[model samples]
Target: MRTAAELKYGEKGIINDIDGSHPSSRRILEVGFTPGQEIQLINMSAFRDPIAFSVRGTIIAIRKDEASCIKVL
Candidate 1:
């Protein structure tokens, strides 16, 4: 498994699991990042702070810190 943030440009994967107990995890799940959904790494800034991705057919941008808590396979 790998982190959502670890996906390179144009990489794609299913949301295998979320591996944290933080409240952010619940919020992430609520945002259509549930297990078994597909996600694609769309782009990243020069600093790679906020990474862009397609989640459940919608493009969403998340901070790298939040992406680290999302596991994909």
Candidate 2:
């Protein structure tokens, strides 16, 4: 039940499920945050609001609140 926002720097996890209740869920999925996809916590801001992740060979940065909707295992 760990969320992407909880991942430590350099930690990796497989995407389990996405909270469709979130307004940006569809956009997140469209960009590659799909179930079964592997994601890594590559970087985070000093405040940790916008975190960067490596998924599908690309690095993407997302907000902590938005990342909370991503369930990871």
lDDT of each: 0.86, 0.96
Give the CA lDDT, 0 to 100, for residue 22 in model 1: 55
- How large is the C-alpha RMSD of every model relative to the true structure? 1.2, 0.6
List candidate 2 segments past 4 Å from native.
none
Distance from true location, Cα of 65 in model 2, Å = 0.4
Task: Quote model 1's TM-score.
Answer: 0.88
Instruction: List runs of model 1 lying over 4 Å from the truth.
Output: none
Task: List the pairs of residues colliding in candidate 1.
Answer: none
Backbone collisions counted per model: 0, 0
Best by lDDT: 2
Worst 10 residues of 2 by lDDT: 41-50
